[model samples]
Target: MNNNTPNNNLTIESLWQFSLQYYSMREIKEACLNLQNHFHGNVNLLLALKWLDEHRLTFPSSQWPQVIQSLGRTEALLLHFRELRRKSKQHLPESLYRDSLQFELQLERQQQADIIDIIHRIELSKVEAPHLVDDYCHQLGAEHLAVIFNKQRL
Candidate 1:
């Protein structure tokens, strides 16, 4: 299929701009590399080639700022998880829950504390909840049905 249109003044700049709409930095970089093999003097190609590290599997150089911010946030969230796990090991003091079932329930609640609030406020009418659950399960590979089931029970 001849993709080129006569009305369009097709150039590297136009293609680059159009590509930016749908292609990620990595995809753009790959396209740039292919373009470089055939054409020269395209700064976008140069940026794409040099933006990547030696492995060709690292982050885009342009996203370093957001990546750094996300890394910091992730580190803090991980620390929170670690401390929460430690707290779980030590136990939250049985005095907090008089009944054993209460303790079990509380533990389950704590396990999902991060997402519980969001789940509670979720409106089933506004969105398809099952799809979200499916996507989450897909991301985790194997998910514990008990977690979502328990949350639904609440």
Candidate 2:
């Protein structure tokens, strides 16, 4: 997880880039959105977990309190807009649905940045990707963790 590690090329910009590339994969966007809709799983956190797994970084569950605290404002804003988008999707015109969803997408990006900032501020343990994935799924309370973790096309 150290910057000096061979795979330690992580920066905020790179993290965001990785998120876009990863989410663009077939079915990944669907899985992430499903997790977000059903489990209250933050897509940003899920993306961060993927990045951390790539970089061999492990974050314990104990660190989540601080991470959650750090994300308070951004998460709240995202949630508010996401709910609006959901409602608009159900009741509003199709044209308005796109706008609302776009706004929520921007908020999700902002929350991703907030998440990467928190990850940068915290200490990371060096562990195998399997261990990191297990830790991340456990912390997220992902009942269907295998589907998301193993659904990668690679």
Candidate 3:
């Protein structure tokens, strides 16, 4: 468990790209949203965990507080915009809703960038993918997501 020198292959852009592809799958998207809605899980963190797992990297439990703190403001904004979008669905015109969704996605991308910055600063260990994903999802009290995430691993 080194405290520095993450794998050279693990770039923020790569993680973002991986997230975009993985989250595009219908099952993965639904599971991620379910974890967010039901377990108060951060979708970006969830995807980050999966991304780390795919790369056989460990996101130490000790780093979670830092990650959470870094994401606080953006997460709040994402939730706020998401709530507004959901609440306004019936009242807002289709084009407005689409714009709102796109804005929310922008916030989501920012959140992912924030997560990636923290990742770049932290120490990551190399370990089995399942263990990382399982441990993380278990900590989130969303073990079911571990299954889905593992099954859908690219």
The number of the candidate with the highest TM-score is 3
Using all chains and alpha carbons, the TM-scores for the candidates as numbered come to: 0.22, 0.77, 0.89
The residue pairs in collision within model 3 are none
Computed on alpha carbons, the lDDT of every model, listed in order, comes to 0.32, 0.70, 0.81
Candidate 1 lDDT score at position 45: 21
Candidate 1 C-alpha error for residue 67, in Å: 14
Give lDDT tens digits, candidate 1, residues 1-154. Answer: 0222121323334333433432344544454444333332222322221211111223223433432232242344444554565566547565543354454434333323322222222221222232332232333342343133213210
- Write the residue-wise lDDT of candidate 3 on 52-132 in tens digits: 877778767787788778788697778887997999899999999999888987888888888877877777777743476
- Best model number under lDDT: 3
lDDT of 2 at 122: 71
**Clashing residue pairs in candidate 2 (N, C-alpha, C atoms within 3 angstroms):** none
- In angstroms, the error of model 1 at 41 is 46
**Best-to-worst TM-score order:** 3, 2, 1
- Which sections of candidate 3 miss by over 4 Å? 1-8
In candidate 3, position 21 carries an lDDT of 94
Worst 10-residue lDDT window for candidate 2 reads 1-10
Put down candidate 2 lDDT per residue, 3-45, tens digits, no spaces.
Answer: 6444345576787888889889868888787777776777787
Candidate 3 — what's its lDDT?
Answer: 0.81
Candidate number with the higher lDDT (1 or 2)? 2
Give candidate 1's TM-score: 0.22
